[model samples]
Target: MFEKDQDKEEWTLSATLESPASVIASGFGLDTAVGEELIVVKAIRGEIYAYETDLSTGAWLLSAEVSVVDSSYVSSRPWNQARDIPSLFQRVFLIRLED
Candidate 1:
């Protein structure tokens, strides 16, 4: 992406070693609930999956299958309007379960 008034930045898209799976992912939610490093992907199949970084291969691996019924990401955050968090909570910690 570029702006009309700004200088153009040239870029190229290339295939990388670290890439997502073939399935169509509807949305993404970061699982910082317990200070664990995980990337969560909500697939089109109505299933949630958590992925972890494979240090040796520089790629992501499936860590766990998050149950949508019990997982707070979809059930709590997406619909709940009063879940706004402060910057301090975000900086020092992540996803305070209480507030």
Candidate 2:
């Protein structure tokens, strides 16, 4: 995350994720956080992360993580067989990229 220092035009890197993953989807939701805003992020490979913003600090904090209890990373959300199959093939092809 980047933030601007007081009286400065440049943005500085303030925080970094311990384990960064590509964000596949995200949505805002109301949770039992005592009025805190929640942002739900579904990452690539079906891992989920929740972020809460600190109104005082202007920074996002990782409040929770939903990991797979099993070995599979596939999520339970409904998927489109037609588009999903092609996308899966594309991902496989990209993973096989070589110099």
Model 1 collision count: 0
Leading candidate by TM-score: 1
Clashing pairs in 2: none
Measured with C-alpha atoms, the lDDT of residue 51 in candidate 1 is: 41
Off by over 4 Å in 2: 1-35, 59-99
lDDT of each: 0.28, 0.26
Q: What is the lDDT of residue 94 in candidate 2?
A: 9
- Error (Å) of candidate 2 at residue 79 is 22
Model 1 scores a C-alpha lDDT of 0.28
